[model samples]
Target: MSALLVAVLLVPALGAAVIALFPRGRDHAARVTGTIFAAVTLIPIAVLPFARDDGWTTYSATPTALRPWTEFDVSWVPALRLDFHLGVDGVSYPLVALTGLLTVLCCAYTIGKVPSGGQGRTLVALLLVLEAGILGTFLALDLILFFLFFEVVLLPMYAVIIGWGGDDRRRAARKFVLYTLFGSVLLLLGVITVAVNAGTGDLAQLTGGTGLSRSTQLAAFALFAVAFAVKAPLWPLHTWLPDAHTQAPTVGSVILAGVLLKMGTYGLIRIGVGVAPLGAEWAAPLLGILAVAAILAGSLICLRQTELKRLIAYSSVGHMGFVLLGIATLTATGLQAALLGNVAHGLITGLLFFLAGAIKDRAHTGELADLGGLRESAPRLAGLLGFAAIASLGLPGLAGFWGEAFAVVAAVERGGGLWLTLAVLAAIGGALTAAYFLRLLRKVTHGPTGSASVPAGIGGAEWFAWSPLAALTLAVGLAPTLVLAATSAPVRALTEALR
Candidate 1:
């Protein structure tokens, strides 16, 4: 089990190295190597559930202390109180699995459609590095270790955007780096303050806001929240996202929506809330207010967006708004809703980006005015786009529905006039979500195909890349318990600590 966890982190780094060393122009070899490594990384995450002594079926009943799939801890830099520690509980398992799944699909997509002007080998190498960084962040248990893994993703993602993105790639890349670096700086300061004051950086030891003084916790939480909010891109700070998404390539956009965004939310739960409950309590109301604002603002922005990718990017602000709202409620159900929403958003938004990219590839533009009626020329493509749009709009019995509904329920259950008011506003945001998506559907798919040449349907590579997300979206929607169950235990533990 230990070896497997280590391999999960190392394999991708090794793959990246191999791809980097591969001869230039050997796109096929690079793609094959990346795919194999990405797929291999999934093995540990896949077997994690079964590897437990109590088995996968018993996960929901397992106690928090006993539920981690594996744990690896070792002394590293005794001076700084850092350890080479890593583990995965139910809360992180699904996200780690999602990362593996999306990385593999992205690699598969690259095999057939390398971005123009991108060196295939270099692109594959950067993706592999990015994958390793994401996986490491989810698995790391020490604050310093987590920070290292978290920052590791920065440069490679910048490369992906700058080297392979669209006309305004440089500007977008610079903006992305600047925003994230500002957050990273704050995050590092918070981590250092917590570690120095607590006398240790081990997350296991610091769970539930233990050890740190309330003042220190408050200070640390404030810093971490700013860092994560920027990443969660909670409004105002979110200006970087639409530009980044608009300029990035299809695969880049998929990973950005699917996995990268989760890093911020996950950190909020794991670090901000978990390690600083009193501070979380202090900030919850303000967080809830900002969340509602983001929900309304993102929806309003989407209604006005002419470009497909930018609209989806703005919608993320709204979707993540629900996640943040759930967290702000500081209740078990709310946190579980946040966790479930995290995974669902990853799957649904990733698929939306894929479809959008395919459209751009065919039509050479993402403008709604330029797209016209896709359904008339390509029923299959139109059907998939409509399906993703409806799912994203929180349609009943879909993956998106459970999270938003539960968030509103959580807010109401919190039982205050402020929460009730927020709940009503959030519900309105839901309706607005439906309006914008329906509007998008009407503009892009329902009308007659414009002058641009329309492809017959989505291609083989697209299907291969898209099928898992499509299946997961339906599977989770029909039986949300599958994911909710996995999250229940950890969320219960975290929320209990807050109380």
Candidate 2:
């Protein structure tokens, strides 16, 4: 199992190097190399089901700290007692899997979709490196190591946005990097403060609590939450997301939606809530208030957006609201809902972006007003878009339904009085979600053909790009237990820590 863990972290880097060395002009070769690497990378993850959960295996972790594939531990600043150590546990597994799955899917979808021109190899290499960072973020158990992986993703994504993105790419990329970097600085301060105060940077050590007072816990919690909220892009902090998504390439948007946003929620669970339970309890109401605000604000923005990609980006803000709201409840059910919501949103939104990219390809633009009468011309494309949009709207029996429903249920049950009021507000967010999606349907697929200029439906590249996500959406919706089962043990362990 340990060996498998090592491979999952290393294969992509190795493959990425190999891809970089190959001739840049060989587009077909690059595609084949990328796909092969992605498939090979999944081998270790596939073995995970067979590897028994060696629960809570302790180590005198090496100096690599929490950095994946390089487990290291050493006294960095001895006076502060911060040691470098890192490892993965049950809590981190689902997210790691999500990262790997999306990497492969995004790489597969990128082939022949983007222009086969300058720096294709470089783009593929950056994507692979980005995958490594995301995987490491999920797996890192050391604060310093985790921060490294957390910050590492910014560069690769900037390249993706500026190198391969749409008009105004430079501006969008700048906003994305600047907003996230500001948060990263706060994250660094919070992490260092915890290490300094706790006398250790180890997550395991912090989880047991270094006997910090309640007031101190609250302060640390505030710092951590601010950093994560920005990444989660909750409410007003979310302005960068739509612009980033609107300008990013298809594969970039897919990765952004699929795995990157989860980093914030993941950190909240691992750091803020895990290390500061009392603080979480203290701040739950405030966080819940912010979560509600995000839900309402995001849903309303989605309703107003005319661009397909921007609308989906706003929709992600609303979906992440449910995740944060679930966490704010501080109940077992709520936490589970947050976990379920994380994976569910990843799948549904990733699919949405894929479909939206296809629409843009055919229509030559993603503006709602510019796109009309595609159903007759492109039946398969229109049908898949409808299915994804419906799922996003939380249609019953679909993958998206349970997460929001469970979050609301948990909120109403655990939070009495004003808590219920907030939960009710969240329910209204759901209603708004449905409304905007319906609006999108009417404008993009159902209304009279807007213009003869709209291109006919999907082609080979588009179908290949979309079909897997479509299938996965239906499969997960039909039998959500597939993902739920993988998350159960981890969510259980995390909730137990709160108790």
Candidate 3:
């Protein structure tokens, strides 16, 4: 099992290296190799549950104190107290699986729609590197290892956005690098502070707040919060996201929204809260307020957005707000909601970006004013878009519903007047979410087909890329227990540790 886990992390890196070795202009070879490697990466994740002693059902059982499954630890830097530690528990397993699933889908999309100015070999190699980075972040159990993996994603994504993106790609890429690098620096400082104070950088060893003073925990948590908030792009710090999303190629947008953003929220749970429980409690109120503010602000911004990709990007802000709100509650239900919301957003939003890309491909523009009555000319494409939009709007019986609804429910359960207020605001944000998406549907999918030439209905490669997400959305929506069960026990253990 340990070897399999190692393979999971190494496969993408190896693929990236192999793809780099391919000569330029071997576009077909690059795409095929990338897709095969991406798909192969899923094998270990799929087998992980069964490999454990308690099997797949163990995730639903009670979780113990801070122990991880399939741990692989080895000495890396003795002087700095760093070790190469990697593992996944129930909390991380679902996310790791989600990363693998989305990477494969994105690679599939790349096969048919390689972006202009993106040499196929370079693009595929970058995607594989990005995949490895995201997967490693989820699996890493040492602070240094986690940071290394987290930083690994930066350059590749910057290259993807600037190399293959739209008119303002360079500017957007620069903004992205600046904001994230600032966050990364803070993240590094916080990690080093925790390691020096705790005498080790192993997360498994520091699971119970590292025995640090309240003051140190507070400072570290603040640094981590700001750093993650930048990546999570929570409110005031979120200016770079819309530009990056709008300018990025389709696969880039899918991976960005699907997996990259989750890194921040996941860190909040796994590192910020996990390592600094006192700090999390101290900051919960402020976090809640900012989360609600993001919810309202993002939705309101979406209502006015003229570009399809930009609107979807803003919608991510609101959706992530729900995840943050859930995290702020510091309850088992809230944590579970956060996990569910994370995966749901990955699936639903990934699909939305794919649909948005399709529309843009056919219409050569993302402006809502320029697109209308898509259902008239591209019924299948419009139908899929409608489904994804409805799911994103938190309609009942879809993946998006449980996460937002339970987040509000969790907040309501928190019971203080302030929490109740935030809950009400979050609910209102949900309504606003519905409003903007509905308005989007009305403006783009209905009325008369606009001047842009509609391409043939969703293509084979697109259907292959999209079907998994669409099916998962419906499956998880109808059976919330699928994900909720996986996360509940770990969340219980985490909340218990905090208490």
Q: What's model 3's lDDT at 3?
A: 76
Candidate 3 residue runs with Cα over 4 Å from true position:
53-64
lDDT (tens digit, per residue) of candidate 1 on 1-499: 6667788889889989888877876779888898899998888779876665334333343222223567778888877667899888888888999999999999989888899867877887888899999998988888999999999999999999999999999999999999999999999999999998988888877878878989998999999999999887888799999999999999999999999999999999998998888899999999999999999999999999999999999999999999999999999889989999999999999999999999999999989988988988878989999999999999888899999999999999999999999999999999999999999999899866676656876667789999999999999999999898777777877877876
Candidate 2, residues 1-499: lDDT per residue as tens digits? 5566667768988888889778757866886687678778888877655664343342223311122222334566666455545455555666777788888877776676664224666777788888888887876667887898899899999989999888898999999999999999989988887777776678766773455667777888888898998888787789899999998988899899998999999899888887777788889999898888988999998889999999999999999999999999988778878887888898889989988887886778888887877777776677888999999889987889888998899898885797899889999999999999999988888877766355564556566656767777777778877777656555555555556
**TM-score per candidate:** 0.97, 0.92, 0.97
Tell me the spans in candidate 1 whose CA falls farther than 4 Å from its real position.
53-67
Candidate models: Cα lDDT each: 0.89, 0.80, 0.90
RMSD of each: 2.0, 3.7, 1.8
lDDT of 3 at 284: 97
Clash counts for all predictions: 2, 11, 0
> After aligning candidate 1 to the native by TM-score, how far in Å is the CA of 157 from where it should be?
0.5
